[model samples]
Target: VEVRPNPGGKGFVTALGGKWGWSGSGRAFVPQLVMYAGPADYHNKPKKIDADIETYLVGHGFNGFHTIVCCRWFDINEERSTRIKGPAPNPDPRTFEALELLIGKVHSAGGMVHIWAWGDESRRQTPVRLGGKNGLADLRLQRYIAARLGPIPGWTMGYGYDLDEWVARKDLDIWHRHMHAQLGWPHLLGGRSVGPNRYRRGAKFPQIYEGLDYSGYEQHQPTYEAYVAALAARPKRPSFSEDRFRVRKPSPYPKKDYTEELTRRGLWHSTMAGGVANIWGKYVRRGQKTTFQPYDHPEWIKTNALFFKGRFVKDMIRDNQITDGVCLRRPTGEHFVFYKEGAESIRMDLSKMPGSRRAVAVDALKPYREIDLGELRPENQTWKAPQKSDWAVAVGEFRK
Candidate 1:
């Protein structure tokens, strides 16, 4: 994951290089930037032209290595729709030049690319024009992107299609296979806007994950377990939680209570739910302000750093060894229970995971230390919280 110096200095620009990731194997990767192409406003401005590639890079670059970058698709399609109606139309020199430069800069920053081709969403007014809303637009755009950036090794392509429409797409499977087989890139085919209203409208989006390789959403259910359960139903597919940037208050200065703890818990929950493959967490700033500086908060960076730094934590997430959510049961005859809370300790149920040995209270802030829970059986065990605040405990068999 990408991180900058504390109190990310005034102005959008920051030092190009600084601490970037936790020094450990299997660390979680974070996006260096989420770029929005097309006009800034919700509508297409005929004269606005292409993305402000220069400004975007200047503001978000660091050490010529952006671990991950996502470009939100907006108007270029409609603007060039007349000439490029065919799926394989010649690449627009203007768009190609701009993307080539932007992508080059991203590559210099050591980051991969993700193109968010918006599909049937409230945020974007322009629908992909290739197939004329026949879902063929998705194919055409994918092909175009593949032809242009396909040769690049580190790149992914996905769409921000709405939940209902995404579910209704009959070509979902075919699209997934084409992207994975032809392009040789992971197809993160899922939608966002899983707000409470969508659920209230009698629409169930999670049920659609069985068809997706990776699922993503900003708002979905109240707790992590619910999202995990839906994701767990399809153990193979992972889930991405684009939690709105957890800010404490509207302030230019960094605040300590930016919901870092809650966000950390959600990350941990996602880690446990999907393992390394299934988990991708993004903390985005909400409100009218456009600039993103979550690193200004102390815990946002530290919590993630610590979680990823721990070799054990990395292995746990990658190996899919962690089983602690709804619709997903703990591994039988062996289990590790990780929880974050304020109390001194919490009870763990080892009913299913038999042959368990002990529980070790781990410090989330500084995760190196461990508190042995003595010898424990496959039943309820009182696991003590290692730290006074923002503590997490790991219950399983590992050095007493």
Candidate 2:
């Protein structure tokens, strides 16, 4: 199955222009630069935009903005009731110019500016408009704009959450087939090789046009991983790793004390990036209203940071790596638990925890409590499920 890269794993932007993840603490502490304030509030008419951005970049250690909220980018299909209203006849340069100024300010202050994509297929307010060329022309237009703007060098060009609504339209299977046929990729590489101009890693988005090069997938890891693998396997693709920028409340969803769950998910093997992550607004419109709840606190931040250090730092901190080690049971205290990292030998004590019925699979925790012994990897046999967790009370166990 396809999987997303774990965002929790501490990694650095590398020399090969690819993000290499490993278990460790990341130095760049990320804070949420929520773009809730209107352009007037940031521009010189009201306040100094560049000075504000500089304050955050140099002073607060916040390096990125989550969105450009209320920027009039979502005017697509305005006549439709689900959309804004009426025909969105023209572009609002005031709003666009303000964003441009904000972006420039952020860049000047040594910060990365990304588009908080609020567009939709229904609300066709995308800067790169889709058209007759099967939407390929729209993509090309986006590329042209990127070419004109030149490269933002350090900025991460990532879209807002609903990325599936954007790319799910592309026939990946079809794209793969034609590209592979053109590239003449080797059969040993898995896909069929057809043409003579064949080469591995064909021309792709980042090379063609640089807009929206990164994906901010706000869900589980599986889908993102699958996409990256597919893109990499194609004729030629850039180093693309999807980011899990948002997700459901890890547990006890919306109970406020879910910070511990944040510690768990962000610091666990499940996440590919670092522990420090920020999600904008509330989960939805009905349950919790969009209140200005600023998540600004040091105790909680360090609490997360400590947990982060414990996971990422193996020797220096408690755990070998932030996203490493074994979690024998689901934190929600559900059935069927083990180290899910495909690691063979992991130590855990499931004795103390409450259990109605217990069975531990010898190989690994599969979906149906099934694991193939023969298919198990050779190297993952270092840590076995421990008889007793050295630090915790003893819980009973049974081997299935």
Candidate 3:
């Protein structure tokens, strides 16, 4: 498939050629997390695992997954312990077979795959490890990967997680050159930049790498302002949040620094700010034997419904001046989407939006229950919610 940046530079389009086309109106890609622990330990039930993951992604409105191609904990030399010898040409045939199977399943489900060469652990796989001495090994590895997986539809290639920490710009350019020469099909290439921390460090990948089709950020605690700023800073290509903090219930960590609510808010915030993609960080149990099950969260499903099913997100742009809260409106003023964090009435200036319109409000906490605001006139109006909590409002021509 030919997947290129949309004309607006806000999302992607796959209409040029191929069996796969854009699925939803959201115009954004949201992928789930899948960390493979090499063939030795995790290849026993590959088919069943692939089926479960496919079901979950299709059922939950996710279009793809952010997958680590290497073994889990590959950064730790002691933990990896000869499990992975080097980059690419993973000696075992079963590994490539399993990957191909998974990719095939994803394509059949109408989803894409974001392939990460490494995991969050970045220090181990450097240019030297990828064969930087003569660059032949690196070129061969790129050729090996492209030859095997390049023909597949609905997938993109990424350098790795936390790529800025270890790989240099010159090395990445060389790798890109090799991959570009090898792959005959059209595909996007990107890399995950360093994440936010106490130091408030911003990612540099978008500024440094000129060949990236989409810019990636690992924002742990994302906000509307931060995403807007980031989007404004890089206006040429689409932006994706590879990691926006994992969503695990029942407090997996002691402090519970991240929560599902935060993740949900981040999803909407990022989307409203023009981010083309975001990954849901739901991890599998860590051990030699890796296992995964579909999450039973309906909130994510509702959010996706609101974006793709309810609204024409591809035609909207961030315009906060239209309302007191976060607003996204079509350039022609036919539709308006507002998101407010607290439960309160929003004052929207709709005088310019002419004609009678229909408005619907959904509480962010309980999005399934939508409260219809009935028909509204084209004038400045104040819309109230059913109760107090985070809410999302959609006002425009109603479709049956």
Can you tell me which runs of candidate 3 are displaced by over 4 Å? 1-51, 71-81, 84-92, 120-127, 195-206, 248-257, 284-296, 310-312, 398-400
Candidate 1 error regions (>4 Å) = 1-113, 119-125, 128-131, 134-140, 161-167, 171-181, 184-188, 191-210, 217-221, 242-258, 275-289, 310-337, 346-362, 365-383, 394-400
The TM-score between candidate 3 and the true structure equals 0.79
The lDDT, on a scale of 0 to 1, for candidate 1 is: 0.41
Best-matching candidate per lDDT: 3
In angstroms, the error of model 1 at 21 is 17
At residue 302, give the lDDT of candidate 3: 51
Task: Candidate 3: give the clashing pairs.
Answer: none
lDDT of 3 by residue, 1-400 (tens): 8766444222222421111124332343334333333433334566665665545564555566555654332222223323556654233455556567666676666566677765433445433454442265546556766788776656776777666666667756777777778887667777766644221335333434766666676665666766776566566666666653555544466242356566567667766675446666555556554454344565555554455453634546788887888887888888888878785888888888868788878877764666889887889888887677777888896342
For model 1, what is the alpha-carbon lDDT of residue 397?
A: 46
lDDT of each: 0.41, 0.32, 0.59
lDDT by residue for model 1 over 84-203, one digit each (tens)? 444434334445445555545445444444444444434333343444332555556557666666545334444443545533444555656666566543323443335332223333
lDDT winner between 1 and 3, please give it. Answer: 3
lDDT of 2 by residue, 1-400 (tens): 7756646443321111122122122333333333334444444442566555544444333444544432253232131224443323233345445556666656555444444433343454343232321245323333332443232222333332333444432332333233234432111001111111112243222211122122222322222233333234331212322232222343333332234224223323222222122432212223633222323332322232222222221111112221244332333332223333435345443333354333333321111122222222212233344332211111123221
